[model samples]
Target: MHELSIVMNIIDIATEQVQQAHARKVDSIELEIGTMAGVEMDALDFSWSAAVRNTVLSDAERVVDRVPAIARCGNCGLEFRVSEPFMPCPACDNVLVEYLQGKELRVKSLVVS
Candidate 1:
């Protein structure tokens, strides 16, 4: 699964941050993952357990903020929550839309010692 790679990347980032700050270890980490970020939470959790061994985030408390997808209609400019891509606007029934949010995967914050 790609979640393994994602977890590995997170470890790399945490390791670099710990070394850069000269910290002993990480206490917690906050992540922002969107509904359409193409990541499976279960897979990510499984991968995290294996990927974080002997790393700075091995014992860090992980918190994930799930971001809901939002879209705006190109024709009516109506904003609405979307679960999938290319959804028609409820108001105008327009297929052309612009994504306002979602599709995000980023580390938001870290608490280190």
Candidate 2:
């Protein structure tokens, strides 16, 4: 799965950050992963376990903040939560909308020590 690559990339970033800070290892990591980011949590967890072996993040506490998808109606200017990308606006039945959030996939914070 692509989650493996994603986890590997995160490890690489953590490694670089630890080196830059001259820290021994990462104590914890906080991630912001939106629902619409298309990452399966189980797959990500599995990938993380394998990718972080002998790395700076090997023993780091991992925290993921799941962001719910939100969209703004183009026709009615109404903002609402959405479970999927193509969801019609609840107020105006508008299919066309702009995503306000829930596409994020990033490392939010790292606690190094």
Candidate 3:
């Protein structure tokens, strides 16, 4: 699955960050996952565990912060959260809403010793 590759990339970056910071150990890695990022949380976590199995971050914990997909309607200026993509605006039934957040996957914080 692509989640395995993604986890590997995350570990690589986290490892580099840990080494650059001269940290003895990594306690945890926090990830911000958007609703539209199309990543399976369970799969990502499982892949992350496997990816870091033999690395310095073997004991590191993976924490995912789920972010909802939010957008603003262009016609009515109404903001709403959606679980799926291409959601129509509820107020004005407009489809020209601008997305303010979602489809974002990033490292938010790292807890290291």
Best candidate, lDDT-wise? Answer: 2
State in Å the error of residue 26, model 3: 0.9
lDDT by residue for model 3 (1-113), tens: 88898888787888888898998767988889898888987888788767888775799887878888999999999999975788999888899988888878898888888
Identify the leading candidate in terms of TM-score.
2
Candidate 2 lDDT, tens digit per residue, 1-113? Answer: 99999999999999999999999899999999999899999999999998899999999999999999998999999999996667999987989999999989999999999
lDDT of 1 by residue, 1-113 (tens): 99999999999898889999999899999999988889999999999999898989989999999999999899999999996666799997899988888888999999999
Instruction: Give the C-alpha miss distance for residue 77 in model 2, angstroms.
Output: 0.9
lDDT values of the candidates?
0.92, 0.94, 0.84
Q: Which ten residues in a row are the worst by lDDT in model 2?
A: 83-92
In candidate 1, residue 106 scores what lDDT? 99
Model 3 off-target regions past 4 Å?
none
For candidate 3, the 10 contiguous residues with the lowest summed lDDT are 48-57
Cα lDDT of model 2 overall? 0.94
Q: How far out, in Å, is residue 81 in model 1? A: 0.9
User: What would the TM-score be for candidate 3 when compared with the true structure?
Assistant: 0.88
List CA RMSD, all candidates. 1.2, 1.0, 1.5
Q: How many residue pairs clash in each candidate?
A: 0, 0, 0
Model 2 Cα displacement at 87 (Å)? 1.0
lDDT of 1: 0.92
Per-residue error for 16 in candidate 3, Å, reads 0.9
